[model samples]
Target: MRAFKGFRKDLTCLGFQFREDKINRTEEANCVKNGFHCAENPLDCFHYYSDWRNSVYYEVDAGGDLDEDAVDSKISCTEMRLIRRLSLEQMLFEAAVYMVEHPKRQWNYGVKKETGTACNGYGVVRGKNPRAAGEKGDFLLILKEEQNSPEIEEIALINIDGKRWHPHKFYDAYGK
Candidate 1:
């Protein structure tokens, strides 16, 4: 079955180095150990690995005995072939496509669940991040990729909050 797997930037998962040129196999899959683990949905890979900037994803064809979860798309199998490594854009595209079929469980990268507004997100290396010089990263998932608008400011990454963040240094009434 077609599946998605996350790996360190070096192509290692757990401690094993997987080769893209060949089919990889292991002992029969057992929960968190003994097999190659993957997910049916691309975004579900994030629940297991979140270093989006430094990690990589692959389209794998998992064969042989498989153990699948009843609820989510988690799966483990003894055989897998790394079909291809996905680029950042490809990862987004795959996730977006999968989310169309499973809309309710999409990853809330930057949007707030209750308010449906932009929220804090993971930081990125400015030069390596796809966002423009001052543009936001995760906010792009929503419609908030507004450039230099007064809404986004020059605050450091960690201090960015939904409220009281401004290009100016003074605190507004909200004390954020």
Candidate 2:
């Protein structure tokens, strides 16, 4: 979450320009609240914030079980795929909407190539599911600590697609 705080500041530091007479303070505030900033040079801020967010998200989900359910065992592989597709669609729609709303602050799609590279190289790499080995086996120590403990009820799944899935942590009655 500290990374989120940094992202917000980076976004604000980037600043935003408006075509209207007055800048929208509310919009900027909303961005800050949502772990983003209102950048005058959105393209630059977009790259900065996106890179930062991607890294943080990767670190958070580096060691969780991606196959687990939120509350019940109803999340099958098929259902999970559907949910992932839907979530991706929603994210794309939101990005499109943002671009449309802020035409003056043109959005750049160039970062797509390097989107997950930072996270992959430094955060979490693919085909390397940390949970598969053991909680403490991954490069991320914090993730191991959280997963090894029975008290941690929630786990974050950082998939290759750059999305987060919060799955419930289930254990035996004796708290195994």
Clashes of 2: 4
List model 2 lDDT by residue over 1-176, tens digit each: 10111123222323532112222232112222321232222223234445443421110101111222232211111100001111222332333333334433422442221112222112211111223111211111111112433222322223222222112322121112
- Alpha-carbon RMSD of each model: 10.4, 18.8
Superposition error at 56 for model 2 (Å): 5.0
What lDDT does model 1 reach?
0.57
Off by over 4 Å in 2: 1-37, 40-45, 50-91, 103-105, 109-176
Identify the candidate with maximal lDDT. 1
Instruction: Go through the candidates in order and give each one's C-alpha lDDT.
Output: 0.57, 0.23
How high is each candidate's TM-score?
0.62, 0.20
Displacement of the residue 91 alpha carbon in candidate 1, Å: 1.5
Tens digits of per-residue lDDT for model 1 on 13-112? 9998999998998878865557889988875676677767778899999998899865468899999999998865565456545544444453434322
| Position 48, candidate 2: lDDT | 46
